[model samples]
Target: MRRPSGRVMVGAAVVTVVLLVAAAGGAAWWRWDTQRQPRVDDVVTDMNTAVADAVAAAGEDAAVAVSPVVAAADCRLGPLRPGKIFTGKADLYTDPGGEDALITTIERNLPPRYAAGRGTAVAGVRPLQADIGTVTLSVRRLSPGWLAVTARSRCSLGAATEPAAPTGAAPGITAVTQLLAAAGTRPAGITEQRLRCTTGDIVTISAVSERTDTGDLTDRLAPALPSTARRFTTGDANRISYRDGPVSVIVASSDDGTAITAQHTTGC
Candidate 1:
């Protein structure tokens, strides 16, 4: 059989190039599609819910602290996007269970719509990654005895929206007010988020503030806490936290690593 002419071969090459470009365009669209919510607030809110569910699956024995829905929401998109990307994070420490073992448990416990992802191992610890659409929940070890579970969303199209302020008196409001007063400097702004946990407890992450100095902040602010408040030490985080009933006040380094920040959480 005779081989095709050079002109025919070039024609075939052009068609292949066109098909490749179309396929590439389609893949990019899929990467940016809104698989779930259409706004940044809604994206982080759903992520918070997923993190809360993972927390419950982690069981009551683990010492859990969650990121503010807005703080862990650090990802940004273009001005005209319809969705946003962010990671809902939780630091789990003081659990007797093996880290990988616990992650496996969480993998099994998330809603079944989440199929397992290609388990990638970082530092020999493979994250328990499960995905539903572009949203994923991943658990991995951060350090010795400290594990972090993150629910991350894809970069889709969305506009950024600040969460609405609490309408009623949250349980931790008084404590937050007192702490802010002791900080002695007015915050630039704050984000108060309330995430509903599957366990029926409303996790109110409130009174988040802009950056301030770390210079003995806890000592200056210790007097403001109620007598019921007692401390819990999280290793090397350069912060202080207290538990009073359902209320927790945490003063940690700001996201920029420039200054201290005070925030509160009401619920586990």
Candidate 2:
């Protein structure tokens, strides 16, 4: 995660303590700064808006997968803090070299006052942190070729929300279909996520599912792939990644078998 914003300092920390108290006691603090302090719902809404702004700046087709509002955690905007926020995943429409291209686009085209590079201390992807007034957005490479955007809201007071179903158009299912056919065992659950592109014409899709049969997933699925497909070796996970088809397909089962996820992600 990224560091806290240093603007308000002591005053913001004091306000955070009050909000945390209100979260526990249902106090009337909500009425004190109805405009300045965002409620939990307000934070989630602002996060979504920031994601949209980023997408528009990139001007690419993408898909979204959002989670419920997570309860109080360390507030990155102030000290001695707790923050409530939701995280969503989205794709940036791209071709080969798209991730870097999209990054360049965001750095050059989006509003400069809000966005800056490499915000989070998180180890994986080097994110572009954008502080768009109400929320902070982190956009970075989700995988080797996928650009995903994640937004974290500032400290707030209010009841958290359950994840709501997002609406968007579906992307091509060819890669996912190829995956399921070779998976051998049926998925315990299947879910589809989509994010509309800035152009409003297309979307990126992610079809995800879990599998219980922890068998030799790689052996069973590898032989089915064409000679053109390449395999990657990640630690412990029995899996393969090949993006030469209609979309990118990744079938990975945990070393113990309970963590398998068959995912369809947009590829460059």
Candidate that scores best on lDDT: 1
- Write model 2 residue lDDT over 1-268, tens digit each, in one string: 9666686677799999998987866435434444455566766656655565575576432322323335636453345334555454454434334466566677666666665676542334456877777777777875554567766766675666543332443343555545656774444444544334434422233344454565667777777666864444433445655544434456666546564555554422
Kindly list the per-residue Cα lDDT of model 1 for residues 1-268, writing each as its tens digit.
9999999999999999999999999888766664533455556666877787777676633445666543344344555443346677776653233567667767666676766553777656567777766467877788644688788877644544466666676655655556666776545545566567755664544455555565666567767767876565555555566666555567656667655566666564
Which sections of candidate 2 miss by over 4 Å? 1-36, 52-83, 90-114, 118-127, 140-148, 159-178, 201-211, 214-250, 254-256, 265-268
State the weakest 10-residue window (summed lDDT) of model 1. Answer: 69-78
Instruction: Give Cα distance to truth, residue 88, candidate 2, Å.
Output: 2.9
User: Which pairs clash (backbone N, Cα, C closer than 3 Å) in model 1?
Assistant: 81-157, 81-158, 82-157, 82-158, 83-157, 83-158
Model 1 earns a TM-score of 0.59
RMSD of each: 9.7, 13.3
TM-scores of the models, in the order given: 0.59, 0.53
All models: lDDT? 0.63, 0.54
